[model samples]
Target: MEKTVCELFAGVGGFRCGLNSIKDKDFSLLSETWKTVWFNQWEPGKKNQWAYDCYVKHFGTSLDLNGDDTTNVDISIVDKNAIPNHNLLVGGFPCQDYSVARSLNGEKGIEGKKGVLWWSIWDILKIKKPPFVLLENVDRLLLSPSKQRGRDFGIILSCFYNEDYFVEWRVVNAAEYGEVQRRRRTFIFAYKKNTNFAKSLNLENNNSLISEVLEKKSFFAKCFPIEKLDVFSIRKTTISGDLADISDNFSFDFANSGIMFEGSVYTAKTYPVITKSRTIGEILESKRVAEKYFISNDKLYFTNSDSTHSDETKTELSSEAKKTWQYIKGAKRKYRTASNGHKYIYSEGAIPMVDEWDKPARTMLTSEGSFNRSTHIVRDLLNNKIRILTPKETERIQGFPDDWTATGMPEKFRYFCMGNALVVSLVSRMEKILDKIFSEE
Candidate 1:
């Protein structure tokens, strides 16, 4: 008594995350069929998206794509009874080329690979012709135009029209809806032309979720006004903190050394060298907090008052610890710096943190890349401890349940999957919608 849904370009189930009881669907037979077809490399430029591999890793039960054991063939290959009978279809198509962030200045049309992915979704819709379809993409898509016609979006208008569907749309921001980050995207809802329903829902409706989701927190929480917030000159500053005592050797500073964000230096006062540095190993206990690590900031402050040095026997630091510090000082001098990112858009600002400890991950990109070089470094404003977020932690950030991708896949592979996944919280609402729709059926 439930509606059937097939997610295309499904990255970690954002479209379906909100739907309860994925167990109700037999997902494996669907995966086997999908794997044989979608993952094949024969088609010209038709291969699985990198994140699709991760999607496959998290299998639904014996349930095929539709959660039905009996109806498991590809839609194009199905007969009348074998095909799923459902009132709705849902998906969030790829949006790289059509994203507002990508085209802040202007938009080129749908020639980009991400733009082309929509055609595949269209192909499925044309073949199956479900009564209703729900889809989402970046707002930039509404404005993409070709010189001949006013906009490529007109093509979408025509596509739905030809399919005998009535289309409606609204622009919504995730931050306004429920997410912490201010992410605005466009959602288009299409229904069979002339179909009867309850009270008519129109385009630009359902904007209540914004306030409903984020009421109290963002209301009184003052946004850090970028214009008014003080910006410091990019002065070349050395990593500072109470360096670990001499007896422990150079290991104390290895993960801790790095440039702190502008004002982070003084704000985080140092705990005692004896107490704080000793506590770090416990803080970094991989098992207790395998997904998090202490990242040191650039500014190192000395808390060792009247602290003696190795050169001077009166120095508080043990001779061995002083010797280790010198090695790091020597290593820092030898370290070669590298460029931040691609020449064009990267110049606007250093890359945002692609990964973080304990917190959810930053957005992922499809590019074959390493995030370590990105602006991923972090210094806890309260504690100067720091390190690059491990790949597993990145998975946690993207809302991939801890270690789901790690147990079976390579760490880099998991990182790629997390990098391409949608924020779980964003997709989680969809799961609830799917459940309500199915329950009524």
Candidate 2:
């Protein structure tokens, strides 16, 4: 079997870059071993489609080896059968309510808008039945929809159970595993029961299977090492029933790490085996940064109080901008009136005015370079000047090549793409285990 891949939600091709070891700034080389047969990228309600444009600019508008088109349309509207079959499927899908309901004909159907994407993935599984699947999502998937905790993830496990696949997941903090950022995400790796690797495991005995697959031999265990599991920390349960039933009634306390096989779930809290971590100071651009990135101390008055001015003339942060950031990051307790005419006290704690260079960076969000409190503000070590991180620095923090998203998008969107991206080195580490599995075939 060839090492073919079908990438879904391919935002600027993070997984592709990692799989092919695309270190060159020009992205000129292609991988001979792992081939991406097809990919789809689409952002709803956006006219520019910057991410899709950047993707096509890097990898040309050519068809895959299987003669399938690299699509930019909404995946929910795409025909599942039209997608080419491949050995592996990978994506970082959005987190949403995974509730299900019975349609007019008594058939199970998706209930919400964003939840439809997961069913699109399920539709592909039902049609193609790919041998392997690797997905990424926010760690909050384990406990979502405040009314009913863990229902969303339980439904996901039940879907895989119905499809005859074994699932293993881990919530990884990149900083804890020697990465540059402190981002935490849930990674799921699933394989079909009929695969050669599944046959090698002791699947009949639950204890033996757990010890072999979840503790030692699984892909996640090999790539991200963890401490030995204490017997009392482990929680086991079985997920049963159709999608609608699971959606309405199923709930479990899913730990940060776990496995699901033949509807049996065994979860536990596992700590990473610490490695040498890289700090924010390590990934800074060695070159001199442009003046626009530096914050200006000059006091400038504006007619309106809105910090985010549409005026392009105001490129650098003014003294007023610094004050706004300080006020947002500072502690505050105030009385406010609700829409119902009730009074209440709102309080929040303070965050450090400047980010520490000695530690890994805080998780980068989509609003990375904005005037928000979560945006990273670092002092340039070379010139000793306060500034926001450059787009190249953000890419380096996420382990992508410099100017990877600099193809044609605006500077703001460039930050948005890196904030949405995953740590490329994490995917690279998992490729080794994927290689071994494919070689067994």
Predicted candidate 2, C-alpha RMSD: 5.3
lDDT values, one for every candidate: 0.38, 0.81
Per residue, candidate 2 scores C-alpha lDDT tens digits across 41-143 of 9998999999989888887653644466648878897778878888899999999878887666644454534536898888889888999999999999999
Position 255, candidate 2: lDDT:
92
TM-score of 1: 0.50
Candidate 2 residues lying further than 4 Å off, grouped into runs, are 62-70, 107-115, 204-212, 298-323
* True-vs-predicted CA distance for residue 3, candidate 2, Å: 0.7
Q: What lDDT is reached at residue 347 by model 2?
A: 62
RMSD versus native structure for model 1: 18.4
Q: List, residue by residue over 1-441, the lDDT tens digit for candidate 1.
A: 335555545555555543332322234444331111111101124253334444555553223344454222232233323334455666676553321112333354223234355555555567777766767676566544332221234445445655666554444443444343234455666666444421132211222321221121110111100111112211121221211111112111111011111111111101111111111122222543332344322211122322222122223444344333122222111122357743331112222332233332233443212423332344433453444545644544444455556545555666666555555554554444434433543
Residue 95 in candidate 1, Cα distance off native in Å: 3.9
